[model samples]
Target: MSRLITIDNGGTLTDVCVIDGQQVAYTKTLTTPHDLSRCLFDGLERVSHEVGDARSLPALLRTTDYIRYSTTQGTNALVQRVGPRLGLLVDDPRILEDLAREEETADLYAALVGSRSAVLDLGVDDETLEGELVTVCNRLAAEGASRFVISVGGPDGAVAERRIRDLLLAIFPRQLLGAVPLLFSNELIGGDDDVRRTWSSLLNAFLHPAMERFLFNAESRLREHRTRNPLLVFRNDGASSRVAKSAAIKTYSSGPRGGVEGTRALARHYGLDEVLMVDVGGTTTDLAMVRDGAVDIDWFGTVAGVTTSLPLARITSHGIGGSSVFHVTDGVLGVGPRSVGAAPGPACFGLGGTQATITDVLLLTGVLDSSTYLGGTFRLDVDRSAAAVRATIADPLGIDLPEALTRMQDTYAARMAEVLRTEAGPATTIAAFGGAGPMSICAAARRAGVPNVVIPRSAAVFSAFGIGFSDIGQTYRTAAGDRPDDAAVTAAIEELLAHAERDMFAENIAIADCELTWAVVDAAGATTPLGGRDDAARALKAGGRVQLQVVAVLPHPRLEDPVAISHTAFESSGTRAVADATGTRSEVPVVDLARQEHGAEGHGPLVVEGPFFTMFVPDGWTVAVSGSGDLLLTDIPGSSKEND
Candidate 1:
């Protein structure tokens, strides 16, 4: 129980970071989508070897204090619309109309439910209704519905829902093999809003099977390795909880939430007021904002454009990234909302991929080296990348390979630049992270009119590293009806605290170590401070619905403050005439960061290469070292060039 391990499992890559006090050891592994646990240990084994003492897997696990994980698999699955076939069962038609009111919601409903839906009339007799339920269930089963959502609306909806549940249970018992999972909206949330609760249940049920399968499997494997601490899942609420206590809906975009935490950390470190973080992963480029030194949050979480009842950090995940498929639509190049995840990855991976991606473009354009990619663990094939570009991009566009390559790079950077332009302002400092984040960030930042750039020394694994700041915690909420007296509110708070105590006790955490904070939240999302019973009564006496929310936290070790360090080295490994996203050619020197001192500062016309990432600083920018050992890229006053 000496090291704290955090793993950020992404669509294409899995990053593992081990923090033992101030000493950090990290590594990356290509995500194996077929068996997630395989990549989980692949990264763990590599990082264990990288540890200072070179502990073995069993030894590292025995001495690990906590293992926290965040993943983008659920986000990718939702984006691709891959999951169990759902058949929605509703008593009222209004629930369906409200869910599919928007065009986006309509598409989601169509994909998740399609025509395999049924509405039951609860006004009929139980015997007749039971027959109707059987017919609807058989029809839905014949229509290829493997999962079901049972939702009801109006004042007596809960009672109707329960009746339907009892009938379904009698019809289909859990003892049977391969029983269809039925999710009820009322069980998921007690909110008055019908649409939000239904959407939340739909998403949770859709994401549950895969999350439970992979997370529990991984945890089981860790136990086989004899690890002492249980795996903690990093949630979108900026905290960690045991896998059993975590909800699938809360895991949506959780990986990006870690990036938001890192952005907040960097912003506070430099005293910056506005920060824009671009986490360029394999399948998505997630954009998060830190305004006035705080990460933005959405109380009503939106996943894949549909609003959910849970609260989540507001991170815009645009489906354009290193592995996003590039296509020619109506003779114009367009990037994606689709990606070739890790299985067949980029064409440069030489893994039987034929589609053109930004990774292929970067490889052909010399931004990513064949011999130095992925810490030199894997080699990229330039010929394969070229063939993919020519077949998928160049020939279709009726252009030469060079021009096609330039156009592809231009389009990729342009799309990212457009996103940055919308999120950035004069005071914004761009934080570039992820394996592919720094590839074209300089050009993208230049296009978006941002001058200062920050590349955290651990940028490639920054999300995993950021999970170190989260404490083991969870939030509990209960609706207290339309309006209530002090006793009702008191009972609600007591019930919530009792639930929190049981959850914390399961983690072997004492009640004394866990700090509890409670508040009264009104129907409209307004919060009243929890001081005494009088406060809750007065706040609710005005006659409106209210809920009692309590958050429990067990503090963890925080990141030690950055210390001052002087320049140690000014050396170059090699030189190459490289063309960047800005379409400029220069003789750039490549320097290995690992070979330099802890806080090495330099000026460009150079490429700073680390084990897991590489940053190309153009001639006009100066790369300096922050006290935290992170790279700070600032433009030289008179040397900034305007885009041609």
Candidate 2:
């Protein structure tokens, strides 16, 4: 079993992939947010047995050298507000003063506002900062501040934090620093955006306790399976890296990274340099552009409404996942926004979900054969599904239950297609990864008019498969400060480079083994190279208004061609009618009418079945079916003429 097994837990699905040299095996499991590793390892166990002899599970794991996992644990913890109350220690004066004065959500991190210990603000002077750290650290420790984030207001914040942190450690003792997870803002942001920097630190602090618990459990489970190698988690920047007790933020985007990396692998296999990837799961639909076998880096984008202006992969996500609900109101029909989540799941799953859902409609319409879902882990209650849909949508719309069911499936397919077509644009091919993605890809592709599609082997756990495909890499960027002079800019550049080196070293990356690249976007948003012996050349050019970008990769580490990812442009939106998901049946009709009207003109029509709402598409759209059984739609304008 001299192989490596990896698990990727997305928001809605868990992907498992086992690799030995080039040979591989994979499987998928529904994500259990409460204890993700349990589901992840269970999936790995299932896949390993399928790949080898049935009796020797330990032998299989022992033959495996390492077990890597990428999880949405950090991201979910943030969204769910499932972690410790934190205290922010801002070393810089203006930043903390503004943060304290500004209202909660002023920077939009609403949940942890009242939750943060009052800012332990230290004035700008070095002497004042030293005094403040001792007092604040003692108070925070006393107040039960489980995590501490130290941020300083400076262009080279990372460099500044390192100096100040050592002083804090000297005063507070290394054991105290370890007891309370301390996140230095500069180290995480790698640039400047007071709000974003603050957000990053806060989010990391929030996930600290939960991540520790999850990782420890995963580590112990691996040991029990006779795995001697330490566990590693892949970073969102597309690289495998070891995780000490402290680095939890790196796991936030891990699931999506794996999918993008796996897509890159597929592109090279097909000799294609540009492509579009669409991953549709139970809670979100993520799309990305791949060019030259790598994801495009758009440093200036928003995630969950927070601005993270770092140059990582360019990907967009929407709230279109598998558990979308179905409903009808005021003589109109719709589906999704609400879901039959894991516990109850789809009505057809027979796990006691009484509500009607898209899976129910699919089963009623014969689009999904419940007997095949998860290889029949649970039996399908087609009768229960019919009763639910009939009671909710069909009866309300005054349409036959069967007709309503057909429309429900078709409409959802149409909406998915519109999203894929708009986001995928006129790119090379469409690749789908995720448990539901392959099943939905074809339907979406037909609607988008995309002619080529790839559902690589192990499409369900593609993200985990991608874990082994990408090169080890990291991203860095900087903000513009008011220009004083070339010398000032040079100082800034030197400071930034020094900070990057320090952070990389902390992560055990060798400075010489990494490649450094620099790019500058001027005040007018024009890009230019800042090539010179002096690192400050680019930062100086954009003084006070420039955006500096850098990416480092361990090239040729494995002595293979860099995966070519063909880049293409795509556009999409993430809108789920949250009110509908949690609303009562009486509210269904009005919601259905409003959503259906909105849906008719877009890619899909709106489907409403009691508390659920699903996306729908227009008439001219066609969908493609991928090998993994995903239904994808493509927007093929004027194709109606040929069909007519």
Candidate 3:
């Protein structure tokens, strides 16, 4: 039997899963922030111990068909400010230069600068741009700048961005110098959010060096274990793509993606049309939406407080997690954005962390296992947890430890519930995952008035299972001109589709089975069904049409520009207010229904679980699992293949 290995890097632990074609064995270990790979390898080794094949484990895992890794390397890099002071070079340096200047004003600018390129024309001359880029690179290199990011103004100028990066890299390979992970603004977001995109790119650069070494070390360790398969790294976007060399952004929020994917699958299995997945891990709580067994992807989700267009699920993250440290703020009681990370974890772990944390409260209150944390690999110190809670919370609130702990938990749950309510609205089932998720899911769901909560088997391994379920997808978007005509919109779609094809080709995806889908949100933000312009126009006119927005959904993951191309496109004024009287403001039509045929088998009350993630499938619902292994929920079980 082929073995599949999945790694989930939680805030305080690294959860590893080894699936021998069917039954899965899993293990967890403390995370080593200084060297994350240490925990990754350790987790894998432990899993090998469980399966009784330490010597042959690596070789078996190597010959395995798939290997997926999910971690927070990029996320950590940004949080710690570990990268070199970045010097940004822009095609148009007005706004970005100003923002960079402002950041420098806080006495934080050790070495950073922003300058405009000498190239003046749209059709960039390689000779001039290359020379100028090399000059910029040399200056930054000498001034102790270890990382650099370049952003040009126009959205369609990828060739220019590539040329500039290639020239600079010729002077510095991965080993010779710290990585300057080049991300062209246009390449990442399709359109221009120069400042935000540049910030995203810079953040990626900051994470590159650390992640490069981490992946290499992991690869080396795997080789020592006789593993020969290429490492399949999970991207923040819920897709597993092979890492060619070293790209750091791919691993950010790996654990969260697993939750989203698992939720999507569960939704399909149980036929739940709308779901809100809440996963509380040691470090953070993540909330995401799955409508009709499909999780939404913003293509460019916000990260580290910066927005970029990456193929990531639309997940809302809060600082509240299992190991979040608790403190009293002016005697009002506060929970955390700060966590008792891995080395010295929560007081409950008995690892020397004296801080009163969520885990401590859970342990003291009998909500968590005192003996089975990490399945007994690590022991919980109930005494330390109780003492910490009493010393910190009880004294501050002038109440007993139990009461203070209960109140603190209530407060955290209330805040999380409010956010979930706003995002999920009414009648959405809560599918909770993560080590702490099952323990708290029922209580949180009860508070939120959510009627159903589903907890699956091996809940801790849900994220790893999700790693097996996700598809490779890309979404490309560009802002439209204020007054776009149908013809103009059509032209834009064609251009985007062409670009999508090119991108897919670069990724080595086949063209025969590929498809194109488009979603257009004009300046106004209204959506029109693809090629249903007459219907869209009528909807707009019905409410004294002022303006409209448009969005398109492509069913195929192989589609190049999932958001930019379609023949029968959705078009509107681009805004809710302009969408007329009808609330059908955003229309998504299946341009190629054939793409949906790749359906996966599912059942009611389906519980899709993964390492550190779980997706609850409600009862009495039928879902369509597509050829891409994508889930689509239907209200009436097995009634319709297409949602529309």
Best lDDT among the predictions, by candidate number: 1
lDDT of 3 by residue, 531-614 (tens): 443443333223212112111211211211112111222121111111111211222111111222333334333333223332
RMSD of 2: 10.1
Task: Give the runs in model 3 whose Cα sits over 4 Å from its true position.
Answer: 20-22, 52-55, 98-138, 146-148, 159-193, 220-228, 245-247, 325-338, 367-369, 395-416, 424-426, 472-644
RMSD (CA, Å), each prediction: 4.4, 10.1, 14.1
Backbone clash count for every predicted candidate, in the order shown: 2, 87, 50
lDDT by residue (tens digit), candidate 2, 274-363:
778777676567888788866777654444455553445777777566767776666656555666666577777778777786567655
Candidate 1 local lDDT, 67-158, one digit each (tens): 99998777778888889888889887888888889999999989888888888898999889989988998899889988888888654455
Per-model CA lDDT versus the true structure: 0.78, 0.60, 0.58
| Candidate 1 regions with alpha-carbon error over 4 angstroms | 76-93, 101-107, 110-187, 324-367, 382-412, 520-534, 543-560, 563-569, 580-586
What TM-scores do the predictions have?
Answer: 0.84, 0.75, 0.69
lDDT of 1 at 605: 66
Ranking by lDDT: 1, 2, 3
* Stretches of candidate 2 exceeding 4 Å from the true structure: 11-13, 29-37, 91-110, 113-129, 139-144, 156-163, 173-178, 220-229, 301-303, 426-428, 476-644
